[model samples]
Target: MVRATLGESSTSASVLCRSDKINWQARNKPTIYPKNFDLTDAERIGHPKQTNNGIYFGIRMGTVYGRLADIHNATFEYLRPQGGAEEPWRIGDFRGYNQAARITPIASELSTEIQCQAEQAFACRIVHNTNNNGGINLDEILTFMRQSGMDTFSLANAYPCLMLTRKGGTTHAVRALKCWDTRDVTPLYHNGAWHERYYIGMERGTLGDAAQLLPTTNGSWPLTVSVFLAGVLAGDHFDLHNWCLTNDGNPAWVLPQAIGLYDACGKSATYTVFDDSPSGGNESIWRVYVASLTQISTGIRFVINSNRNTSSTTYQLFVDVAGCGSNSKTFTMPQYSSTNLDFTWNELRMGPPAPAAGSTYNIRMQIHSMSGTSATTLWWEGQKTITIQ
Candidate 1:
């Protein structure tokens, strides 16, 4: 974790080191010890090892400089931990670097499936409410889920997570989780406290505490209605152009399908040219407007998924070059409507014709409906610009 920052105005003299001189110095520092050890039967029975403290490790941050001479060719050092089992089941090594730096010991338990099931249950509640109108209000959902053995329910904490405004002053709290497999959602609620709750696993899904928040719900909150698909980079740059609709009975804007380029921070960096045509209008088409040259990271991610398409009808994705003309480079996305789909493409290729570094373009899409017009709801393009990391 040694950060070497080089400024544009910095000169060679600004560096902390000088002339590569050799120096070995030791100060009066106290010695440190490893805290982990084996537990004997007597120690476990009489004075049981407290698991609350848990095990610990150390991290040393330093700078390595070139030496004047070599040390006996290349000597190898074999280091091993004491008082630990040698088997992989008891101990193992994990390492990740660069964009995917991560490490975890076997002691860590994985709750992805459990939490996913919880998230699915929560989503089902919303789907039920959407299908049955206001029949399943926010309060009823909270109470029922709590009674059903939920410790907590995580909600999105962003703009749409403000359940108060959407519920018309209802006393409850609710928000939606933007899923990679489903539409970016906007749940409802109000007057909710921020803390750990039992009965449900909500302690794992708290907004800001668990995940990001979204905007409020749309009108009527129809369950058996259209599905809104919103596309985003990583953090917050929402795509503004080209949205898709399906018969989910949910509000039109519940899930918005946006289009835009983003930087490393998941912030919108490129202008997402959106086809802002009215939903369900016959023969209406829209295109995203890339206004200027925007610097997007090399591995810009383009995600596409189905949102709130509760109906049994099949849905698909199609891309077309709308800026230059009606029929330029028309490309349809592969069948991406199985539950939810994630598609990543080169924004440069998807950019306007003859795109340059730090430039912009307009790309449009058509979420093909199997039968007739099911009903369109959300539509957004390059509304927000992703911040470069």
Candidate 2:
């Protein structure tokens, strides 16, 4: 029977035999030397492996654990960042994008307009002498007009005992003109003037069907008043067969020359022009005569003579003396002394009051010059009448 002997002092038996070294054993267990072989130390190997001589190994393991702890801390910080440069974060900057992802924030804008209500207060403000019974106040009117963008306007100064206010100064608040209306004042309600009023009623199809009265200031005596009449208001789009502009006569006390019409918007629409004559020389008169009523159903006339005479003349029909519809007329006269040519009911026939579109009214006028002086020229400027429907 062969038996093996273990070594003590950590010297193998085979090594001891070859080198002739001393060997030792503890209860037949092999022993390792401190320098050549190491026994596991529980302090260094963490409790399970307990042995002596573990200080040096404990130191080496402690160093490795420290390095591992540092690496773990760094790896944890890098994976789950906090806030520093090494742990960068995007909080609010990237949060808004979440809402954008749900829906696009782009949309078309709807158009709208502002409109004024009827109950909205008008710009005109009014003030009067509470002490005096309500009377015509100039200051109030002036202030209202000024606030309404009429800065360079003047009220009638003749009404001395009046309070007129106007918009002036930097702020331009309505102010009193400091005039006293101690006496009862009656506003002139008529006599065409700039801003004057006239009351007249005429048949719709008659000359009064289209009329333009003057503006009414104090609603009274004739003054320089410009007038315009139409289905639309000033600065409005033009309408068909409805617009007349006329002026009242001046203070010269002369009835304006009456105007007659051939169509609602006739080709020869007459417009009077007034010359600012010192003596009101000749009320400048211009008339647009319908040379031919071809391709027209209506004739219009605009006369601006004086502000006090806002009137219009419209003809519903035109009839000749031949009692028939003829395109031309001619006559040779022996003399001329205010020739009188009248058309009786039987001698003349009238057409429709309103002609159809493209209908024509051909007028032929013939006059003879009797005054012989190497072909003397005669001026025919007078009222000529024609029967109309």
TM-score of every model versus the real structure = 0.22, 0.15
Candidate 2, residues 29-57, lDDT tens digits: the string is: 11222222223322112212222211121
Q: Where does candidate 2 stray beyond 4 Å?
A: 1-190, 195-342, 348-361, 367-388
lDDT of predicted model 2: 0.20
Candidate number of the best lDDT: 1
Tell me each candidate's RMSD, in Å, in order.
Answer: 23.2, 44.3
The per-residue C-alpha lDDT of model 1 at residue 28 equals 10
Tens digits of per-residue lDDT, candidate 1, 28-73, equal 1111122223322222111112222111111111111121011011
Task: Report the alpha-carbon TM-score of model 2 versus the true structure.
Answer: 0.15
